[model samples]
Target: MTTAYLYVLHGRRGKIPESNLELLAGFIADEGQLGRIAFLEGDEQTLEDGIRDLQGRPGVDHLAIVPVLLYSATHIRWDIPERSAKVLDPSITVTVTEPLAGTAAVERYLERTLGAAVTAFPGRRVLLIAHGTPHFPEPFEELKELASRVGRTIGVEVVPTNHVGHPTIEETLADEHGPFIVERLFLTDGRLAAKMKARVQAIESGDVFLPTLEDDPVIINAIRERLAEAGV
Candidate 1:
């Protein structure tokens, strides 16, 4: 059976974010697989639209959907599957790969990004930020665990917080009076990320802000690993 890879993510209805997805699709396509991009939210190409487009292609019998998400939360575990199932043809098999929650590539990226901050500040705790969900706490919990693991390796305390949920970035950094590092787990440099960046800026000064993940190789490799896990 012929399989096509679909890179899906939360859309922000902007050209740059869409371009980021296009770039990711290009990288995956270089691996000799047919690929497409879709959005789960916003006004861009929808997941249903992408499925239809792929189904229209000749000899495309199966779809390997790799959600470009940071964690295996509601969108990965429920939304994608439900949305894809509704539009998929019975003859076409579909596999929704796991999100990039605990991937080694991500861990490496975090370590490399935070290494400098730890060196500069010595014993200061690092603030790890993620675009968290208010409906479910799994994403926040998962990020916390990931932070804990990375903290152990780097010899520093990695404090994880949701920019939108409980233990928010605002509250976490409220009582802080020293230099700190803020590492974001956001995938693209979109509107949401911009809002979080502004929040960080307003909260403190001299707190180092690590770069956001924008078409980073770690993300590309994580997506590749997800496709591999699904046997695509």
Candidate 2:
């Protein structure tokens, strides 16, 4: 049997506050299946190196890197593959899985993260916030579509806004009537997420601020589903 190993590659933030990548790494390792997590941004060695280190214990033949990324950004398209190739082993079959977006997996995560807000206030609006880069806007667009899908599923008015693509998040926060719930929509709790959270705090009616995708247990299943979808 050719053993498989899963490396959950995470985007770089200043630190590992978002998913507690280190903790999840341990969790997946302890699960003792083909599950493992690697935060690309972490100071640890590359996925290939990790597999090489494991060579003595088990003769692994397959490796899959499940991107813990929320966007289809450059990191997904370029950085991960390039680095993986640099450290590739001729023996191990490597697979880079799809980035998470516009799927039932994401909707489930939204439900768990914001389930409390679904019925917390009778008429509060849901503001889904995401970030974008000047070079590309597709990431934000993709997230907007996912937000709409989630809103329809939950039967709520979801206003999709971007922190970088536009100032729409501020507009959504200012224009929305009465109390509103803010969901900082990203995996990492980095500078931008922090700024958005602070802005939400400034709003008197921004009563409920749900957790970001970082360090949440629900994320594990979501990643697993994506990996399964890719036949990992």
Candidate 3:
């Protein structure tokens, strides 16, 4: 049997979320298995085609559909599995794992990223920006706890801000002073990151750090570690 693992990415159409893809790729690469790894982009056609391909592969005994998302919202918990069943083989054993937000590795990544921001800002105020979801409380709360932990560790005051929901960027920015630095807490350079840059531009005295998806090796390593923990 081939024992291949199918890594499925869940998100909106046209947006692949390269950072998550890169992270997943890194983990698979580190495992030293090339042909055994497969990717499925999010979309109706792609999801169906990917599952069909997996089913046709004679060597694939187990299919682990890992959701490349941050939260366990409707998409990760329900939509992905529903779509998978459309093409999945009954003989094959398939398992769905939780999103990245459920891992402590993500919290560690956030700590390291925010710690660097705190060190750079020194006495200045710092804002950690996250892409929030109103329906999912874990992502926001995990990000907030990360900010608090990093603040306590570095002995600096750090404020956690969300772009879409509660503790919004506007609300957090309103209470902050000048010369602040806004560090993006997202895994990729997408709409959220772009909005954060625009929000920082409106602030007269603050600066923003635009780190690319490949900027931090710690995050890459963390993803690898998480995958190992998952026995992937």
**Best candidate (score: TM-score):** 1
What digit string (tens of lDDT, one per residue) describes model 1 on residues 1-232?
Answer: 9988788878754432553665686796678778778888776688898898987789999888888888877888788888888989899988878888678888888888888778977767788889887888778888888999999989888888787878887888786544677787888776777788788788777777777888678888787677777788
Clash count in backbone of candidate 3: 1
lDDT of candidate model 2 versus the reference: 0.68
Local accuracy by lDDT, each model: 0.80, 0.68, 0.64
Instruction: Name the candidate that leads on lDDT.
Output: 1
Give me the runs in candidate 1 sitting further than 4 Å from their true place: 14-19, 175-177
Question: What is the number of backbone collisions in each predicted candidate, taken in the order shown?
Answer: 0, 2, 1
lDDT of 3 by residue, 1-232 (tens): 4445566554456544545555556766876642222334444436666667766776776766665556666667667778788778888787566666546676666566667776766776667777776777777887777778777876777788788778777877788765666667656676658878788677645575746334355554554555567665
lDDT of 2 by residue, 73-169 (tens): 7777777777777766777787777776555666787865565677776677677887655557787677767777777777787777777666455
- Model 3 misses residue 214 by how many Å? 4.5
Ranking by lDDT: 1, 2, 3
Task: List the lowest-lDDT window of 10 residues for candidate 3.
Answer: 33-42
Candidates, ranked, TM-score? 1, 2, 3
Quote the lDDT for 48 in model 3.
66
